[model samples]
Target: MNTIKDQDLSKNQLLVKNIVEHAIDQANFTIKNLSKRPTVAMLMECENCLTDFMPVVKFIADDHIEYAPIYDQMCAAIDAVQMGEDLVEIEFA
Candidate 1:
């Protein structure tokens, strides 16, 4: 992916980034308070929200450059949540 900074984002890209950030933040929040590993069904709402933002990320900028980190954060959060890890503590790639 190409490199794109936060300051470089367009209006549309910023909007997409906001939604994706919300998805990841909420997902992390849900898992952070839990004491046990989450089942996929347990994370269904967060997962669904994240999934819904997938297509939006791809359109955020040329080659989806500006939103790559958001996409990565979503993937990492989902993986860690599904794996019973601390979503808030995990540093997404």
Candidate 2:
């Protein structure tokens, strides 16, 4: 017999799995498209893209951390590029 906790766990796992799979797909696509071997700058560009998307994911998937292994795996896909000052701060004029 399934409990409420079991159902919630299942939902979290599915959410994290979907996120991890998407992250992996994005990483593979970035790796494939490099004109030259990927440089730190190029990878940083990819990281920038990921960071741009992260806020939206965080908002939508606030519950996702309950299934951390999959979340970590998603993070690992682009792990090499650390968040730095290059992530722009937007200013409204």
Candidate 3:
């Protein structure tokens, strides 16, 4: 199972990760035109203890849908790795 094992992650971290992931997914599904570009605002939060991690809203995507999705996916994957088991073994399909 895909997951993250963040030993030092607070609740806010998890929240931020979730929001970013959701935004990325939404962008992928909602945005159609590659030229139009899709943007998403994410609120960062703690992982272990839910809290206001950051005050400023994080923005994803500028004008390149392809790059945005790739970056988002990488960020999400990294976050998952930090939150999952200490010894995570992923099997890509």
Candidate 4:
């Protein structure tokens, strides 16, 4: 995937980036990882952490078909992770 270097992000991309970073921080995680946070499970370490960020995910997913399904799958995985003893490998349809 292509990466936008410093000072090259569009307003929308920057907004999304800031939201993701805020979610990650609110989950008590460090930001030393890569930018390709394709999976919410990859960004969050635990179910509670994912739960903490669900509101932001819902906000982003609302009315955004491109991201809604992805968010839905991650939300399912989060519920599964919380209820079961296994990590669900849920993916976008």
Candidate 5:
């Protein structure tokens, strides 16, 4: 799992992580193609928000089991930030 600096996570990270986690959990086919791993592009209305998150994560996962938990953790971290809470203990299984 990757923990991006709090200062470097976009508002859309929360949304995108949520969406990606859902997709991973629900995708019917085995995610066997490492070269075609799912990519998430965060879209923001404000350029400032767009500038915060790192644009991409490479070598993110080799399969769904690895990807799902990480995506869930990322979403949880972003949610904690949005709720005015400290993300002091975020981790993936």
Candidate 6:
């Protein structure tokens, strides 16, 4: 028989998996729609896309300390996109 701790862990794992997959799909959709826009606009939209899902990632990290790396990755990815936007602005604007 599965213990209570085991059951809780399984549920958390499923929740994390769903959240990550959904975030990936959401980002992908946003990126696909942005492809025709200007480079700067694309980067800005991408930043906004990541920003929108960041809270969900944070929520996961808050409840599941073991998934902190995923949260860190999300932060790094957002920072990189913001940097790209800054570079594009510097180069063209």
lDDT tens per residue, model 2, 1-93: 667875787786777567655654564455444324456777666766566555545544466554444334335544544632222221111
Model 1 lowest lDDT segment of ten: 84-93
Tell me the spans in candidate 4 whose CA falls farther than 4 Å from its real position: 1-9, 17-45, 89-93
TM-score of each: 0.50, 0.40, 0.28, 0.49, 0.31, 0.61
Error of 2 at 17 (Å): 11
What ranking emerges by lDDT with the best candidate at the front?
6, 1, 4, 2, 5, 3
Per-residue CA lDDT of model 6 for 33-90, tens digit only, reads 5554647677778778779887887887798786566667667767767665321110
lDDT of 4 by residue, 1-93 (tens): 765565456866667756755664544342222123424555455565667677776787784555576567557756655554344443334
1-93 per-residue lDDT for model 1 (tens digits): 755565556855667657656655655565554435456665666556556755565455337575677667767766765665666532333
Give the whole-model CA lDDT for all candidates, comma-separated: 0.58, 0.51, 0.34, 0.55, 0.36, 0.65
Overlapping backbone residue pairs in candidate 2 total: 0
- Residue 21 of model 2 has an lDDT of 57
lDDT of 5 by residue, 1-93 (tens): 766666456744565566444443322111222113422221111121212321221124323354555545545544543453443332334
Given candidate 3, what's the lDDT at residue 73? 42
Instruction: Give the C-alpha lDDT of model 4.
Output: 0.55
The segments of candidate 3 whose C-alpha lies over 4 angstroms from its true place after superposition are: 1-9, 32-93
Candidate 1 structure lDDT? 0.58
At residue 49, give the lDDT of candidate 4: 64
Candidate 2 lDDT trough over 10 residues, lowest sum = 84-93
Position 83, candidate 5: lDDT: 50
How far residue 52's Cα lies from its native spot in candidate 6, in Å, is 0.5
Cα displacement (angstroms), candidate 5, residue 67, comes to 2.6
Worst 10 residues of 6 by lDDT: 84-93
Q: For model 5, what is the alpha-carbon lDDT of residue 15?
A: 52
RMSD of each: 7.5, 10.0, 16.5, 10.1, 17.8, 7.5
Using TM-score as the measure, which candidate wins?
6
